[model samples]
Every structure is written in C-alpha cells, then in structure tokens.
Target: MTVATTDLDRLKSGADQLFSKKKLAGFSIPLVIIAYLVYIFFAFDVPGLYSRADMDNARTLVADSYSYKMHVTRDNRSAEVDISIEGRRNGTYPEDGSPDWVTRGEETVIDLGQGHIATFGPEIVTYTIPGYGTFRAEPGRSGVNATFPDGDLPGWINASKNRVAITTEAGRFTVTRNRTEVFRYFNGWEAFWFTLDSPYYGLSVGEVAGRAVQGEAGDIFTAFWTNSMWRHQDVAWALFETVLMAFLGTFGAGLIALPLAFLAAKNFAPLMAVRFAMRRMFDFLRGVDALIWTIILARAFGPGPLTGALAILVTDTGTFGKIFSEALENVDKAPIEGVQSTGASAIQRYRFGVIPQVVPVLISQLLYFLESNTRSATVIGAITGGGIGLLLTQAIITQQDWEKVTYFIVLIVLMVMAMDWISGILRRRLISGDGTGH
Candidate 1:
C-alpha cells in the first residue's frame, strides 16, 4: 500500500510538469506571433503605403482593362482633324469618314452622350457641359488661352496658361499649344477581328457568317489573323515560344538531373566526397533564383527564348536533383537485389529494378514542374526579350494599351491552364503505364 501511494505521487508530479509546459507553450506561442506581427507592421510601414496609394489611377487602370477609347484629335497648327480608334493609324476612319456620333464639315462636332458635346473649329476647341456652360480653349504660339463657364471652375476641369484638361463621366478633353484631343470611351475591344481597312470591319456576326458561307471565309480569316493593331499572328507565335521555353527547360532539366541524382543520393554514391560535392552543386543552382539565371544566360546568349529556356533548365536541375536524390535514398532495395542475383549488370539493375520503382515519382514530379515552369517561362521570357512576356511588357510600357495588356494576360492564363490540363493527363497516363509494367 505504501509503494502504490509512492507510484501515484510520482505520476501526479509528471502530469503536473506536462500541464505546466503545455500552458507555457500555449501562452508563449501567441505572444511570439503577436510580437512578430507588430514588428512587421512597423517595418513595412503599412500607414505610409496607405497614404501613397492613388485610388483614381487605380480606377482608371481597372476601367482601361475592359474598355477602349476613340480619339478625335485636331492638330492646332494645321487645323486638321482626325478620328481614330485608340489613335492608331490602322484604326483611322477611311477617307476622313467619322462615326455617326461625330459630325464633320467646316467644324467637327463630337456628341458625347449625356449632354456633353465638343466642337472643334479652325484653331479653337469648345466643350459644352450641361448644368455647367461652354468652355473654350484656343491654342497659339505663346500657350493655350482658356475660358471656363460662368461659375467657379469645377474640380473636373483643370485649366492653365499652357493646357486645359476636362474630365467627365462621358469622356475626357485636353487642349495644348500643339493639339486638341477628345477621348470617348467605348465598351469592347476595338478592331479586334477586322481593322478599319478591312471590308468586314463593321459587319454583324450574322452578316459575317453569311459572307463566310458565300466564300469570304479566307478573306475574313486573313484580315483577323494579320490585324496590324492586335497582331494576332505575332501573339500566337509568342505563346508558342513561351511553351517551347518551358518544354525545353523542364525536360532538359529532368534528363540532366536524373544521372546527377545518383551521385547526390547517399545510398548510390559510395564516396562521401562525391556526394557532398554533388549536393553543394545542387544547392548553388537552386539557391540563386531563376530570374538571376535568366539575367546571366541573357548576357551569355543575348536576348532570346533560348536564354529563357537555359535559365529554367539551370534552376530546375538543382531542384530535380535534390528531389530525385531523396527519392533514390528511400527506394526499396529488394528489387535491386533481385535483379542483381539474376546476373544483371549495374546499368541493367538500375533500369530493371530501381527505375521501375521510382518511375512514377519521377514522372509525377516532372509533370508538376512542367506546369509550374510554364508560368516561370513567361517572366523569364520578359527578361530575355522573347515569348508573350515581351509583348505584355511592351503593352504595359505604352501605358495607354491597358486593353492589350489585359488581352495578353488572359492569353497567358489560358496557356498555363492548358499546360496544367495536359500535364495532368500525361501524369495519369505515365503512372498507369508504370503500374501496368509498361
């Protein structure tokens, strides 16, 4: 009875210590998390970021992604007015023709719906806003002379000695010493299928289909495929280049890493020195980012898809080597011994025994990386000046081509999705084949 009491007391003491540690851990963990969060909040300067944010520019960028703008511009020096879609020469109206909303004669009158009208005369531009009044600006050698409505100038109108800018819900107007421009926002992609020069430019879908049935299919396809404004052919080729980069990089990495993985695997390489060297090599490869690799390769190979491919290959090789080596270490030895007992050579043993065991893992990792590398290739392409990334960068650099940027982004997303789907299918097939001894 005395011994039992002693044992019970010991158990009670151990339980009390465990509970005390648990309580301490529970309290300490939360305190540490809160402290780190506080440190980050101050370090990142969240308040300063909030202050620097511009909601108006953000709103404009968002709007530009979904919509297009038509420009009605008049050269103040020459008094020549031109109406073009997005101010592109290929999108310019034929023979100085104008949209129905714009009336052209001695003066050009653009009717921006909702009681906003702009008239462009010889050397002067006038904007009439309902509930406000007429605003006029005449550009001369000195500067732009401006006049505003009767009351105080509204916040939407910015007028100065050199330029006058008016922004409203319907459109925007800007007048400078060189040019007077009116921008009208429109919904949908402008001249995406057919440019202003094409005969099918303004045709309805039904009408286009009818014309196609009448043997105009080739012409319509040609017009759309060769659209100068959108450059559909060039975009398609760029997408292909991006895919190629990912393909060459991922498979090339896998091929190069498979053999090197044997050197890195602790079980395979008998020499500790060789194993350590291989591991450090892999560390060097993966430790540096893919972007850095892209820059280095670009310097060596010049700017091209090939440089991007090499970057991906170099970066992925280290990753694959580490993963494959770990897989090799965990492999079952029974099959390898069985093959060796049958008088199999070292190479044959690996092929018949080790490879069969790890093929599923190998294929699975390769496919997953292929899908991920497709995305990486895009950024790499941008750095190397190849693939759709180049086009995306160009569009963004222009600043006014946000719609084109949106289109490129959508295409990139679709490309990645397609790669993911294909990789999934390929992975399934490969795994099933391995299971069936194929």
Candidate 2:
C-alpha cells in the first residue's frame, strides 16, 4: 500500500512539472517574440526612416507615373520661344505650330489654364495670377531681377538673386539667367499613339478608326509603331528577347540535367563515387543564386542575352539535377524489371520503361520552371542589358520619365501573366498527352 501511494504521488509530481513546463513555454514564446521585435525596431532605425521620408516627392513621383507635362520655355539670351512635351527635343513644337492655349505675336502669351497667364516680352517675363496679381522677372547677365506684389512674399514663390520660381495649382513657372520656363501638367501620356509629326496626332479614337476604315490603317500603325518617344517596336522586340532568354535557358538546363541525373541516381549509377560527385556538382551549381552567377558570367562572357541565358542555365541545371535525380530514384522498379525480362539492353530498358514513367514529372517540372524563369530573366537581362529590364532600368535612372517606368512595369506584368497561362495549359496537356487540358 505504501509503494502504491508513493507511485501515485510521484505521478502527480511529474504531471505538475509537465504542466509547469507547458505554462513556462507559452509565456516565454510571447516574451521572446516581443524582445526580438523591440530589437528589430531599434536595429532598423524605424524612427529615422520615418523622419527621412518625403511625402511631397512621393506624391510627385506617383503623379508623374500617370500624367505628363508640357514645357513652354523662352531663351533669355536668344529670345527664342520653344514649346515641348517634357522639354524633350523630339517632342518640340514646330516653329509656326503652337497649342491653342498660347498666342504668339510681339509677345508670346501662355494661358496656363484657369485664370493664370504668363507672357514673354522682349526684356522681361510676366505671370498674372487672378487672385495673387501679377509677378515679373527680367533675366539677364546680372541676375533674374524680380518684382513681387504687396504684402509678404507667398510660400509658393521661391526667389533669389539669380533665380525665381513660382508654383500654383494651375502650373509652375521659373526664371533663371539663361531661360524663363513654364510647366503645365496634363492628365494622360501625350504622344503615346501618335507624335506631333504624325498626321493623326490630335485625332479622336473614332476619327482614327474612321481613317483606318478609309484605307490608312497601315500608315496609322506605322506611325504608332515607329514612335520616337515611346519606341513601341523596340519595346516589343526587347520583350521577345526576354522570353527567348528564358526559353533557351530553361530547356537547355533540362537537356543537360536529364543525363547527369542518371549518374546521380543510385539505381542507375553502380558506383557510389559517381553519384556523390554528380550530386555535389548539382549542389554547387544550384547553391549559388542565379543573379550571382549572372554577375560572374557577365564579367567572363561580357554582357548580352546569351550571358543571361547561360546564367539561368547554370543555376537551373543544378536545381534540375537534384529534382530529376530524386524523380529517377522514386521511379517504379516493376516496369524496369519487365523490360529486363524481355532481354532488352540496358539503354533499351531505360528508354522504354524508365523514360515513360518519369516523362510526366519531367515535362511538368520543366514547364513550371520555364514560367518562373521568364520573370527571373527580366532581372537577369537588366544586368546583361538585353531585355525589357534594360529599358525599365534606363527609364527609372532618368528620374523624370516615370511614365515610361509605368509602361515597362505594365508590360512585365502582362508578360508574366501570359507565361503563366501558357505554362499551365502545357503542363496539363503534356502530362495527359492530350490536346484537352485535364
């Protein structure tokens, strides 16, 4: 009876210890998480990051992605007036041509929408704001001599000895020693479908379609496709190159991996040394990320689409090797033995029995990787300077052409979506060996 009572007491003690451990673990987990979060908050300098963030610049960048601006610039020395979109030479207006908002004569008068007006005269530039009255500046060798209205200077105007700038809801104006310029913001991307040189520049959608129906479709398409500002043709070609890079890399890796997988698979490789070496080789290849390989190869082979493709191939070969070897290892032995029973050669057995069983997995993995590699190729092309990523990089580097950045991003998203759809269809059809996706 004493032994039985002692055992019961020991069991109760053990249960109490177990319950204590469970309670301690539950409390300790939450405490540890809280401590780690506090460490991260300080380590990342979250307060400093928040303090450094600029909301105005963020708003401007976001606005630029969807809208474009027109520049009306007057050379102070040459007395030459030029109007252009985004101040680009290719988007400049012809000498005699001007938007309806501007009147050219002895003085070039610009209507900056609303009640804001800016006029360029022989020696001075004047801006008239309905509620704020008029402001004037004479830019010359001395400086931008400026005059302001009564009361204190408004926060919207920035003035100095050499430069003066004014910003309003309607537009922005600036005067410097060399030039006086005004920027008028618009809602959409101008010259997207047709540039100023095109005959259909200002035509409505219905008008363009009517012109196409009248047998000018070829001319219309040519104008849009050859657009100097957007370069739709060049972009389309770059996209094609990106997809080609992915295709060549993915399929090339599959081809190289399939043979090596045999050496890595234990059932196929009689010697353990060969399997170890092949498996290690695969690990070394796939262990390094593709971007790292891209940088290394770019230095070796120089930069191009081929370099990007090779990088993808090298990294994917290792991955494919590991995956294919596992698949080969998991293959059913029944079919292989059946093929051997027929007195088939080793190669014939592998071809007829092993190949048929693993084909579905091979095709499925290859197609999925092909799709994933399409997106990877874009980033790889940026380093190699061969695909849409190059154009996207260039646009982002400009710091002013956010609309082009938007266009490139949209194209990339569409390309990825199309690849996903194609790969899904192929994965189903190839696995089922039928046209209808199962």
Candidate 3:
C-alpha cells in the first residue's frame, strides 16, 4: 500500500509540473508578443508618422494619377499668354488657336467649367467662384495687391504679400510677381497618342480607324509614334530594353549555371573540396541582393541596359547553381546506370541520363525566374538609366506628370502578366512533355 501510494503521488506531481509548463507557455507567448509590439511601436515612431501623414496631399496625388491638368499661364514680364497641357511647351496651343473654354485677347478669359471663371488682365488676375464672391489680385514688382469679398478670406484662398493662390472644385488660380497662372483639371491623359500639332488630335477612334483604312495610317502612326509630349517612341524603345535586359540576364545565368552546378553537385564532383569551393562561390554570388549588384555593376560598366543585365546574371547564376545542384543531387540513378550500360562515355552518361531526369526541374525553375526577373529588371533599369523603369522614375520625380507614372506602371503590370502567361504555358509544355519527345 505504501509503495502504491508513493507511485500515485509521483504521478500527481508530474501532471502538476506539465500543467504549470503549459500555463507558463500560454501566458509567456502573449506577453512576449505584446512586448515586441510595444518595442516596434516606439522604434518605428508610429505616432510621429501618423502626425506627419497628410491625407490632402495623398488625395491630390491619387487624383493626379488618373486625371490631367491644363495650364493657362501669362508671363507678367513678357505680357504673353500661353495655353498648354500640363504647362508643356510641346503641348502648347498655337498662337492663332485656343481651346473652346479659353478666349485669349488683351485680357485672357478661361472658363474653368461650372460657373467658375478666371480672367487674366494685363496687370490684374481675377477668379470668380460660384456661391463665393470674386477674388482679385494685381501682380506687380512690389507684390500681389489682393482684395477679397466682404467676408473673411476663405480657407481655399491662400494669400500673401508676394503671391495669392485660389483653389476650388472647378480649378486653381495663382498670381505672383513673375507669372499669373490658372490650372483646370480634366479627366483622361492629354496628348497621349497625338499632340496639338497632329491633325488627328481631336478625331474619334472610329475616324482614326477609317483613316487607317484609307491609307493615312502611316501618317497617323508617325504622328503618334513621334509625339514629343508623350514620347511614345522613347517609351517603346525603353520597354524593349527592359525585356532585353531580363532575357539576356536570365538566359545567360542559365547557360553559365548549368556547368557550374555540376561542380557543386556532390554526385558529379568526385573531390569534396571542388564541391565545397563551387558551392561557396555560388553562395557568394547570390548572397548580395540584385539591387546592390546593380549599383556595383553600374559603377563599373556605366549606366546602361547591359549593366542591368550583368547585375541580374551575377545574382541569378548563384541562385541557379544552388538550386540546380540540389536538383542534380536528388536525380534518379536508374537512367544514369542505363546510359553507362550502353558503354557511353562519362559526358554522354551525364547528357543522356542525368540531364534528362533534371531537365524538367531546371526548365521549370528557369521559366519561373524568367518571369520574376522581368519585374526586377524594371527597377534595375531605373538605376542603369536604360529601361522603362528609368522613364517611370523620371515621371515620378517630375511630380507634375503623375499620369505618365500611371502609364508606366500599367505597362509594367501588363508586361509582367504577359511574361507570367508565357512562362506558364512553357512550363506546362516542357515539364509535362506535352507534344514533345520523352
């Protein structure tokens, strides 16, 4: 009875210890998570970030991405009034021509749509907002002489001694010592395909198609492709460079990695030292991120598509070597033995036997990486100043051409999607041995 009671007491003690551990783990995990969250909150300055965040600027940026603005600027010194899309000289209206909403004269009047109207006189600029009274300013050498309605100045109008800016739903108007300008926001990208000089600028799609059928296609296409404002030709060439960079880098890595992989594979490399050295080389290559490699290569090769391609090659060669080596290690030995039984040479054994077993994996990984690298090349191109990414970066830096940024982003997405589809189809066809010899 004493022995049995002692055993029961030990069992109870063991159960109690296990329950205590479980309880400690349950409480400790939540406490650790809470502590980590608290640390991160302070470390990243979450409160300051929230305070600094400007929703108004965010909204304006988002709006600019989808819409365009037309600028009607009057040079106060030159006394010259010019109407242009996004204030670009290439998108400027001819001296004899003006938009229906604008009437240029000694005093230029811009209809900002709705009831809002902006008039730029020789010395004075006036903006009239509906429901609100007219806001007036005279820009001169001294300052912007301004007057508001009887009531206090509204928040929408920003006024100072030297400059006065008015903003409303209809448009924006500003006056300074050097220039008086009005910006009217509009939907859709302006002068995307054809600029103001092109005869097909205002034509409907159906009309353009009709003209294309009527043999004016070449003229229309030339006008669009050579457009100075949008630079469709430049964008097309940049896109081609981006694809070429990715293609050259990915395939180059594959070609180079295939042989190097054998040196890293334990089964193929008889000397352990050779395998270790080759594997370490691969690790060194892939260890540095592609962007870091891009920076290094750009300094050496100068900024170009070739530099971007080389960066991708160096990074991917290492990754492919590691992956290919592992795949080679796991390959079935039956085919290799079968090939050897035929009195095949060593190279022939590898080619006819081992390669066949791992080819599917190699091809699959290559295609997947090809698709992934296409996206990476865009960013790489920006650094190298060679591809569509360069154009995108330029647009973003300008701050005035968010539409162009959107266009580039959309093109990138489409390019990536196309590459993904192509790679998928190839992966299916090659890996499954569909419509191909075993």
Candidate 4:
C-alpha cells in the first residue's frame, strides 16, 4: 500500500535525526570501549609472575657478579659468603685459574696497630701489623698468628684483590704474568676497573692466578684490548667491500624502480588499466621479507656477501618503487601543467618538472633504504657467509665462545650506529640542499 505524503515526510525526518547523532555515537562507543580494553590488557597480569626464589637468586647473582661479598646478619648471627660470577670464562680469576691451580684464598684479620713481620722466599707473602712487626712462610701458608701485644686481633681485614701474592724477603716481589714463574721476579696479579666506582681482575689476573699462564703464553688482557683482531689490510678491504656492495645494489635497484614507480602512479600514467596492475605488482614484491629473499638468494647463488647485498637490492626495489611512485603522484601539478602549456616533450617535462621536485625525496628515501639495507646485509651475512656476521656465526659454533660473540656484536652495533649517523647527516644535507653539488 502507498504511504501518505505526510507519513513519508515524517519517516524521512525521523531517520535523518537518528543518523546525525547515532553515526558519530556508533564510532564513539567502540573507541572508548577499545581504549579501556587496551588499558586493561597491558596494565595487569598474573599475580607474582616472578617467583620469590627467582628474585632471591637474581639479587644473589647481581651481588656476586660485581665481586661484592655478601654478609648476612641478624639475631646475633653473622655469615659472609661470595656469589657466583657471570662473564666469558677466560679464567681471569686467581681463584680457580692458575699455573699451580693454587687459589690461595688467604684471609687474615690483622691489627695495623700491632707490628708483626712475615717473609717467604721469592713466592712468599709478608705483611706487618703497625707495632707487632714481621713473620714469613713458603708460597702456600695458612692462618699463623703473631703474638698479640695485649690485643685479641687486628682491625683491618687483609683481603687479597682475589688471591694472596707471594713476596720476597725484602717484602716486595714484582707481579708479572710470564711462563716459567720468572721466579727471578714476581708480578702482582692484575686488577682493572670495570666502571667508575669499582674494579675487577683483568684477564691477566685469571691467567696468572690459575698458574695457567705457564701453559698459555703472553697477555690475555692485551688480546681483549684491541678494537679489531683482523690486521689493518683485512679491515680496509672488508670495509671497501661492504660500502661497494651497498652502492651497487642500491644504484641498480633505483635505476630499475624509478621508471616502474612512475608508470605505476596514476597521475603520470595515461593507462589507468595498467596502473592498478602495476601497483599490485609493486606490492607483491614489497610483501616478501628481506631476510626471506636473502635465504632464497643464498640458496640459489651460493652464500657470499654479494648474494647477501643483492638480496637487499631485490627486496628494496619493490618497496621503493611503491614509495617513489607515491612521491611522484604527490608532486606539485602546477609545474607539470606549466611545462605542458609550453608543449614540452614527455621526457623533458619529467626531467624539468617532476624530477627536480622529487630528487630530494628520492635521495632521502635512498639514504634511508641504504641504512635499512646495511642491517639486512649483516643478517644476510649471518646466513650467507658474509662480513663479520659470518665470522661471528662460525666463532659461536666452533668454540661456543660467548665472549668472542660479544666481541663481534660490539663491532656490529658500533658499525650500525656509525652508519646511521652518517645517513642522518647525508639525509639532512640532501633535504636542506646543503650537499656538495652532486
């Protein structure tokens, strides 16, 4: 049945009022609800996720890790003990690592007020209490007390940095880390500062204290000191190789994608039919991850740095094609129209009107891509036997040596940070038109 004109008008008027407020209200309720839900999702969790035992152990671990001996005291009882350590096991502590394998955990409660003298041959330890004076023993000795001058014990707790040192009759011996004990002279165990406030034994201390120094010659401390284990030549060549790979890959990809991005963008392309298809093609290439491409490339090309860098180039081309075309589409049309009004050729119009406007953007994108691709190169290096990463993978597998891994990782991190800084400077220069005229 046909509705009356008045009824139809009433129905339309009610519908408009309902939609005007409800349209925005529909979105508002969900927004507020979702925001509240998200807040709940992150703000709370299962109770006591970290067990009491874990916290106790972690505190013990941290205290022990820093060489601080922990003392427990309450209700007329006191116990002091050391915690276990964390680090690459280079055997730096005199405790378990030494030539005689002798860790002389020598502790003495001495009064600086009393005088006592002690002496040993070349490998003896001697300390004098102020008034009590001197006493001596062989390389290995236990608690031998000097007569207290009306005193129960001395005040200072003479704790070795980690182990006891053997001194000569003259009360002094050189602390050296040399094979064969150099019994000719003694070198004190080495202790080096880790942070501003505290110090820990250096690798040499572990080497010498363990008496393992005799078995292993030279200084472990010196070894850990250098920036790169590689000779200067290898470093120079490897650096050249990395820079060249990035340049060649980025240059090749840019050349291939610049035109593709133009054709893919509707603003420049007359064929709207092809534009959507090309845009989808661009998306397809960009969808595949870089590391995934690296794996495929490594398999097909045989693993190498070139294969790794090329993988980055292949992946980046698709991503940049999409980015470049969008940049192209977003270009100011005033210049393009002005050029067209003069009846300029297509190539000339693009060269004069489009490229100049977008060159800075393109360069910015390229530089950003370069920075991104460097990390990709390193990951690829891990998979494909390239750069320091390949060496790192090998080192980890061969020795299970976390220290060496730490060493390589530090280098990689520093390199990445340096590259980022360089890229940021170049990007700023390009955008601000301050780059040396290219």
**By lDDT, who's the top model here?**
2
Question: How do the residues 288-391 of candidate 4 rate in per-residue lDDT, one tens digit apiece?
Answer: 87778877887888977688778777877888889889998899999878988899999978877888888888888898777766666666777877776676
For model 1, how does the per-residue alpha-carbon lDDT over 1-438 read when each residue is reduced to its tens digit? 999999999999999999999999999999999999999999999879877998877786898888889999999999888899988888899656888999997888999999899999986789999988899888889899888877788898888899899999989999999999999999989889998888888899999999999999999999999999999999999999999999999999999999999999999999999999999999999999798898888889999899999999999999999999999999999989998999999999988889988888988999999999999999888888999999999999887788899999999999999999999999998898666343
**Model 3 spans > 4 angstroms off:** 1-31, 54-56, 121-125, 135-151, 434-438
lDDT agreement of model 2 with the native? 0.93
RMSD of each: 2.5, 2.7, 3.0, 13.5
The model with the greatest TM-score is 2
Off by over 4 Å in 1: 2-6, 136-149, 341-346
Greater-TM-score candidate between 3 and 4: 3
Per-residue error at 151 for model 1, in Å?
Answer: 3.6
For each candidate, give its TM-score against the true structure.
Answer: 0.90, 0.92, 0.89, 0.51
Better of 2 and 3 by TM-score: 2
Residues 26-102, model 2: lDDT tens digits = 99999999999999998999879877998887887899999999999999999899999999999999999999999
Query: Which ranking of candidates, highest TM-score first?
Result: 2, 1, 3, 4
Cand. 1 Cα-lDDT = 0.92
List candidate 4 segments past 4 Å from native: 1-245, 341-343, 434-438
Per-candidate clashes come to: 0, 0, 0, 36
Which model, 1 or 2, shows the larger TM-score?
2
